[model samples]
Target: SSFETKEEQEEKMEKSEQAAAAFPPSFSVSEIKNKQRRHLMFMKFKQEKRKQKLQLKKKKKKEREALGDKAPPKEVPKTIENQRVYDETTVNPEDEEVAFDEGTDEFCSYFNGLTNPKVLITTSDRPRGRTVRFCEQLATVIPNAYVYYRRGLALKRVVPQCIARNFTYVMVVNEDRKVPNGLVLCHLPDGPTAHFKVSSVRLRKEMKRRGKEPTEHSPEVILNNFSTRLGHSIGRLFAALFPQDPQFVGRQVATFHNQRDFIFFRFHRYIFKNEKKVGIQELGPRFTLKLRSLQKGTFDSKFGEYEWVLKVSLSAVTVFFKMQEELCCLI
Candidate 1:
């Protein structure tokens, strides 16, 4: 390549400065290099901004596709509707026995030797009037059950006392606004604590009479509309409240209603020996309970479906024998 001489370069620079100055005084020749650098930087900034905008647009498109413009329809499961009958001939006396030895290795054996399983119904230390009343009512409903105020006793202390006293279950009534709104059921020795929502509690007087007033001697139980794993757990819970070998000669019958995952419990005694053909006696209280939520290991409403909190815990097993007894009557 041919190189320009110093005199030629000087002449070219003078000509370029003259051309720039002829346009406007504000367009200074001395600022030409700085202006070129600024222009290049501005172009790079614009390119980066355009790329970011395109990336955002793509992300928004993906989100729209994933969510869909319209939601899909929900699915409903089919259910069976029928009345189940229990034959007296199928009752086996030996099957009614609950062997605590099956899973009692880790816990003490006080409950194993007890002839009657007891339930302790209690409220929080500072229980409201409604809670206290509910506890009393529940104790009456459950056979061999009694009520005691917690009196600020910690769970660590309460649990050991219950075990020592041969109590099979400890029921805690949680209150809100002076009304029983929640229940905590803990199986003794081995745990699998269950939390349940309490609603629509009615005494016998509060319920609408369907037929003749129930007899006083006959005992009855009703399990209404409980289905699935949780339902099974609840049904067993109800069974735990009663004696294993109940006086069936008095015509004790537990009616379970299993429809749409709702459980209704009615305990009464059935009699069909006399000319009346069929008769019923209210053995336990009438109440409706629905399992809308639960927590594993322990009962804490604040961590379940009704609330947003996380807590750790364990398992549930109690009603294998009751379930077998009711299986024959399931329709």
Candidate 2:
């Protein structure tokens, strides 16, 4: 135990020495935050545009339906006609548990005078083999200040970029992102709260009209504040749900840093209907994708999903889908 303690202290000293080897490069936290805000702004604009289109469509569909009511049968496909009249909406009601329903765990409290540390955030734009690698040279410069990372950039998630931003969950940014066996949440029992949420600066500005904070916080604002803590717990939730295959619901289960890289793991999934045919997905405005098959598998006689997993990556995937003989005749 004495020897192990000495070795541990030596390792710590060595890491500290390396962090000090490089003079702290100054970067703007405000600029990064602003960029993040701008990206969010565009998302809002895009969503509103989609909503307008849907609304206009609904109106047209209703008018057509009324016109059809007066006419004979067999004008248009009933399925297609019905789809237009209904306005598709997803309404997420606010969570009932807002006020920290239970007493705070001593470990999970917020602290001030935070350090600006450097850690390798997950970013995808790297050599294929190099994608999964972690940047180890991050350090805390000052208390409650900022984090300085060694890497030039971070990765984006394969899933919706919004999920990365809207989550104000359990992100314990330390000097290193690598989790030791048990010390990941060491500060959590008594950590300072810093929540992150996706909101337009325009929205925030509009809400306050002109003040420090909004006069009356939006329901989402409350959720955003609460969601930061959720970031802390997402590991458990992610583990439970997508333990073997991260892409559980046809949506890519992944992790990303806003300015950094994106990591999508446990990717081998066939939930999407057309696995035999190559497909493309626009993950975000920034990234596009093509799936390459690494190995063709025996098709499930009933389901038609490939039994073999592909050696897939955001880059560096080799796809080889067994061509369909029946489709060849049609082609």
lDDT of 2 by residue, 70-164 (tens): 74455665674255443233122253442342223322222121221212133222222111211111111011112223153321221123233
Off by over 4 Å in 2: 1-103, 106-143, 148-331
Cα lDDT computed for each candidate against the true fold: 0.60, 0.28
Candidate 2 lDDT: 0.28
Candidate 1 lDDT (Cα, 0 to 1) = 0.60
Q: After superposition, how far is residue 138 of candidate 2 from its true place, in Å?
A: 11
Instruction: State every prediction's TM-score relative to the real structure.
Output: 0.49, 0.18
